[model samples]
Structure formats: structure tokens, C-alpha cells
Target: MLILGTGDVRQVLDGAETEVVAAVRRAYLLHDQGRTALPHSVFLRFPDDPRNRIIGLPGYLGEDEPVAGIKWIASFPGNTAAGLERASAAVILNSMATGRPEALLEGSVISSRRTAASAALAAAVLASSVPETGVSLIGCGVIGFEILAYLRAVLPDLATVTVFDLDRSRAEAFAARCEARWPGLKTEVAASAEDALAAHRLVTLATTAATPHLSTDACRPGTLVLHVSLRDLTPESILAAVNVVDDADHVCRESTSLHLAEQHSGNRDFIAASIGSVLGAEEPYRRAEDRVTVFSPFGLGTLDLALADLVRRRAEPLGLGTRVPDFLPGPASGADG
Candidate 1:
């Protein structure tokens, strides 16, 4: 198997945000076209420490490439305190022609960028306002930074950003980065998540909370909640909003928002739409006057696979990534004989 390390992946993904965003958009379009199979992600929770959780997501992209594969990204939130990232992932691409593993890629950067791009794309479609209105970001970590960068790219009206993080230092540092990279755009630290939500009509939740933190009552009317993390909002909050998710099957299965809504309503019918429908133009992104709009994306495997495919294609010309010869050898030529 070709081993594309994290450094290689980062090199391949550097300065490729626009392309990554486009690739993720295409993945959502594939979903809208009903040309993809996105199964619910399977989670293996630690028996002792629930905070240590691993998820397995696998999917097949459409027939647009010379190859195909399933992506598996494992997330462990406790890794942060150890000075490590909250999650570490690797993506494996298999050749349909021979049914063999073609690439085993480092998935950290790919996962984060694709996730941010998905949210940015959804915000472009669903938000009623423009970048002039600005956006409030809750949880200014890795995902938060990426989202802010992409938001700037997709929404020219995004002239300001208000941020809130449990760690005040992190928020301040993020603000400094924004000042250096996105000058003239206002970046301030909010005292609380509520303060952040109230400051801007557009909000994004990138918290690592395994449970709910924000609620509908804390938000402003007509606000758009970009929920990139699975379980950042309460069920009451979810049911209160015009809910949009990446995949109905996947989000409803693993999202904390869905879990809370299910616990309260005893059903999964509260979801109004998946972001894919809006992206695919199959359904319009309608805003209800009486409710807020919530976009929850569980980070689809197809998105990762799609982006990985793009990275592999680019890295080839740039002489990036390490190659592993005979990763699958001759393949399973005569299996079950």
C-alpha cells in the first residue's frame, strides 16, 4: 500500500482549499443525484472513558474517477490534552478494477479541510444574509480556523468574526492569526458562547463536546447555526431550528443533535433537510420566520474519499507521498476457492 504520511498530505493539500471545497461540493451533489451510498457511521465507544471514541465511516463515490475507495477516520478527543490533535485518521483507496488497496493516506488535513469546505458550501446556500453580516464562531480550534478561512473565500460579505472558546488564550491566539491573515476584518473574543451567538447572525459550532452545550434559547432569531461537530447543540435546540444535515442516515444515527431530538421526540422526523439537497438544487434552502436554521454535518466518508482522490492526483505530479509497492500484491484473484 502506498503510505502517504501526514507531511505528504499537508503538502498536497496546501494552497488547495478552493479545489478541496469544490470536490466536497461535488460529493454532496453526488448525494443529491442519488448516485452514492453513504451508510451510517459506526462508533466504538471506550468502555471505560467515553471521551475516547472511534468512528468508522465508509462510502463509495460516483463513477467519475479511475478509482474508488472507502475512508475510515478515527477521532479521539482526549488526544488534545497530550499536545496531540483530537483526532488521527488514515484513508484507504481501493482499485475497483482489481479490488486491491491502492493508497493508504494520512487523513488529518484532508478531513479538516473537507469538513470546513462542506460547512462553507452549506452556508453559501442556506444563509439568507451575506458576508457583510459576519459570522460568530464557537470553538476556535483547528476546524474553526479552517471554517473561517473558507468562509472568507466563499462569502465576501464576511467582514468580521466574533469568536468564543472555553479557552480564552486559544481564542485570543486565533484572533491574532486572523488579524495577520484576514486584516481589516474584525476578530474579537466573546466572553461566552451566548455572547458570541448573539453578536452575529451566522454562527458555527466546532466544539469537541460529546454532549450539548448551546441551545436555541441562547441564539438570536433568524440566526444560522453551522454545526460542524456532531453533538454541540441540545435536542430542544435542534428541534427548534430548520435542521439541515449532510446525510439523513448518517447524521440521524451519530449526531448529538439528532440523538437529543430523538430522545425528546422519540423519532427522527424532526430533520427538515440535508445540505446535499440544497447543494444539488433538488430542494431550495428555505428559511422559516418562526425558527432558526441549523446545518449539522457529520463529516461524510465520501467527502474524505473524494478529497483524498484529489490529493493523490495532485501529489503524483508534485512528487509527494511515499509509495508502497505491491500493497495488494496480485489481489484476491480466486477467493473462496
Candidate 2:
């Protein structure tokens, strides 16, 4: 087994956003082709603390170089208040040939990068083509920063973006980071999430709330929402939009706002199509500009695996990660046999 730390993973992914974005898009296409196994993510919650939970996503990406893996991620909203990251994750990949663990990777960086890439890819198609259209970012955290980093690569013409966070300090810090990362990129601090939502033609919801807080009243018609944080919008808000997701089956589960909307309506007629379908089509689908368009991604494990595979392939040439000669020992009976 090889152990890839956060720094190692970061080094591998740095300056590789375009490549990673393409890899993530391929993963989506493979999934759309029914060549991947993406079981519903398993959620483990606590009765006393409903705001925090750990999720396990097991997936198989089958093709010429098939690989299987599971990503275990934990989300603790209080971590930010304690001066720590809110989300941390690790991903393990197993070889198809041997069915053995090939790598154990620190996954928070991979998770956020893949997630941001997924959103940015959606933004490439869904965001306003007109330059300088307002973009709002809610929940100024690491995820927000990652999204901004990728947006800088994909949508450099986005002139101004408003930011909102429950903590004034975080919002200010995020705004400063945005300015440093993208010069001449205008940013404003919103008095509230509603103000942020209404201030932009493109809105990104990355808040920490486990339950719905946004409503249709906050959104304007023709707005494109990158709902990176699931469960931040009410079911009514979800149903009111022309929804697009990475995976409908994956997103429409785990009590996400979309799930609640499906439960409320007893059908998924509200969802327009998977982003993959939209991307894979020869011609773009026509969406009414008067209706809100939302792209809510479930953060596919196949993406994590793909990115991790990239890191592994890149790092191996440099011999970056720590290698364990034999992470899994054979049975004593093998000696007698």
C-alpha cells in the first residue's frame, strides 16, 4: 500500500485543474454510459448531533483500467467555529487485477477539487455567457475558495461576485482571498444569504446548514444556482427550478433538498436531465430563461477515484507517497499450504 498525504495530493493536483476537470467529465460520461457502479452513499448520523455525519461512497469505475474504491468523508459544521476544517475525507483504491488495496489517499483535497471542478463544468454550460454577470457565493469556506479557484480557470470573465457567510470574519476573509486570487474580480459582502442570492445572476449555495434555509423568494427568475452544498434549499425552492444534477438517483437521496422535493411530488418530473446527458448531447437543450436553472451535484465517488488515480499515476513517477511493503499480510496457513 501507498500512503498519499494531503500535501502530496495537493502537489499532484496543483496546476492540474483543467486536466482534472476533463477527467471528472470523463467519469460522468462513463457513468452515463452505464459503465460504472455508483451505489447510494451510506450516511451515518448521530441522534444527539444531527448536523454532523460521515458518509461512505463505494464505487466501481469499469473500463480498460477498472478500479474499485470507497471514500469515507466526515462533515462537522462546528469545526469551523473551532478553527478547523468542516470537511475531511480519505479515499482507498483497490486493484481490479488483484482485488487488493493499492493506495490509501488523503481525500479532502481530492474531494473538494473534484467537487469544484464538477460545479465549474456545470457553470461552463449553465452560467450566464454574458461577461460580468453577478455571481454570489454563500458559505465562505474552503469549498467556496476551491470553487473560486476553479471559476478563475473556467470563467475568468465573471467580473463581480458577492459573498455571504454567517460569520462576518469568514466572509471578509473569503472576499480578500477572492481578490488576491483574481485581480479586478469585484466582491461584496452581503448582509444576508438572501441578499447574496438576489444580488447575482449566478448563485452558489455552499452553506453548512443540514436542513433547508433558502426559499423561492430568495431567487430571481433565470438565475443559475450551483447548489454545491446539498440540503440548504427547501423542497419548494428545489421544485420551483429546472433542476440538473450529476446523478439524479444519487442526489435524490439522503434527505437532500432534491430528495425532499421528490418525496413531496411523488415523482422526479421536476428534474430536467442529468448534466451528463446535457453535456453528451450534440446540441444544447433549450431551457426557458424565465425559469431558474439549478445544478445540484451529489459529489460522485467515481470522480474522487478518477482524481486519485491521476494523483497516483503522477506521483508514482516522482515517488512521492509513502510505500508500505505489505499492508495486508497473508494468512499463516499459506506457509503450510
Candidate 3:
């Protein structure tokens, strides 16, 4: 088994935002066409630590280089207090020919890249055709930085950015990073969540809040919300707009905002369509120009698998990772029978 570290993975990516977006797009299209196999994500909770969980996502993305893999990722919200990253992950890829695990790549980097790509892709598709002055970011953490990086790559017209965080210092620091990327950008710190929500035409919510806080009234008509943090908005807020998701079955679970919306309404009538359907469509899905558009992705394993494959292929020729040839014990046992 070949093990690729975070440095190796980042080297493979090399700040290529368009490539990452394209890879994420392929994953979505394949899934939409029923060409991928995605089992529901499995979450393991600690009895004593309710806020901590390790999730396992196994999937297969069919293509010329069809690959199967599982991403084991852990989320510890408390880690922030200790000044550590909130999440970490590892993706293990298995070969189809030999049914043997081929590579174990450091997954947090790939995970964040794919997530940012997904959010950016949604932003590009759902963003208003009208000219936007700036964008707002609710949380100013690593994920926030990732989203900003991708947005800078995709949205060249961005001239201003507003950021909000519970910690004023963190928000200010995040603003500095944003300015570094877009030296011409006007970066500001929002006084409140509402202020941040109303900061611009395009908004991204990446906060670590555990439950619903954003209300329907917070959004402006024609606003494009990249609901990256699944649980940020209230059920009524979700119903108040035309909602899009990466996958209906996936998003309407784990008591996410969409899940809450479904529960309150007892149906998924508020869901407009999957992001896959909206991408490249001639006609707009949001029937009303005044309707607020929201895209909530459940972070599919299909995406992780696709990106992992990309990293693995790129890392191979460079001889960047550590290889353990005999990770498994033996060969097939059926011959004895």
C-alpha cells in the first residue's frame, strides 16, 4: 500500500482550482447518471463525547480508471478550543483487479479541496447572473480559507469580502488572508451574523454552530446561499426559498437544515432540484427572480473517491509517498475449496 501524506497531496493539487472543480463536476455527473455506487455514510459516535464522531464513507466512481475507496474522517468540534484542526481524514483506495488496497492517502487535504470545489461549483451555478459587488463568509476557519481560495480562482470580479466569526480576532485574521489573495478586495468584519448574511449578494455559511440559527427573513430575494454548514439554517428558512442539494436522499438526513425542513413540512416539496440537474441547464430552476437560492451538499463519498483517485494518479510518477507492498496477509483462499 502506498501512503501519501498531506504535503504530497497538496503538491499534487498545486493550487489548480479549475482542475479541482472539473474533478468534482465529474463525480457529480457520474452520480447523477447512476454510474456510481454510494452507500450511506456511517457515523460512529463516542458515548462519552457526544460532540465527537468518526464517519466512514465508502464509494465507487465508475470511469476508465474505475476506483473504489473509503474515507475515514473524524470531526471534533472541541479541538478548536485546543488550537487543533476540527477534522482529519484518511482515504484508502482498493484496486478492482486484485481486490487489494492500493493506496492510503492523507485525506484531510483532499477532503477540503473537494468540499471547496463542490461549494465553488454550486456558487458558479446558483450565483446570480447579475453583477455582484462582494461575498460574505460566516465562519473564518480553515474551511473558510479553502472556500475563499476557490472563490478567488472562480470569481475574478470579486472586489469586496465580508467575514463574521464569534471571535473578532479570528475574523480579522481571516480578513487579512482574504486581502492577501485579493489585494484589491475591500475586506470587512461584520458586526453580527445577520450583518454578515446581509453583507452581499453571494453568501457562504461555514460556521461550526451545532443547530439552526439563520432564519428565512435573513436572506434577500435573489441571494445565492452556499449552505456549506448543513445545520446553520432553520426549517422555515429552508422552506422560504428554492433549495438545491447534492443528493436528496443524503441531505434530508442527520437533522440538517433540509432534514428539519422536511420534518416540519412532512415532505420534501421545498427541494427544487439536485445541483447536478441545475448545472448546465438552459432554463433556470428558481422560477421567481425574487426567490433566494440555497445549495446544501451532504459531502458525498463519491466526491472523495474521485479526488483520491486524482491525487493517487498524480502522486505515482513523482514517487512522493511511502509504499508498503504487503499490507494484506495472503492471496485468495477459495482455491482450497
Candidate 1 vs. truth: CA RMSD? 2.3
User: Against the unseen true structure, what C-alpha lDDT does each candidate score?
Assistant: 0.81, 0.87, 0.87
**Over 4 Å off in model 3, which ranges?**
280-288, 330-337
| Clashing pairs in model 1, backbone N/Cα/C closer than 3 A | 1-327, 131-157, 131-158, 132-157
Note each model's CA RMSD in angstroms. 2.3, 1.8, 1.8
Rank all candidate structures by their lDDT, best first, as comma-separated numbers: 2, 3, 1
Q: Could you tell me which residue pairs clash in candidate 2?
A: none
Q: Write the per-residue lDDT of candidate 2 for residues 78-163, one digit (tens) a residue.
A: 89779889999999999898788889999999999998999888888765535435689998988888887787788867788899
Candidate 1: misplaced stretches above 4 Å?
129-132, 282-286, 330-337
Q: Is candidate 1 or candidate 3 better by TM-score?
A: 3
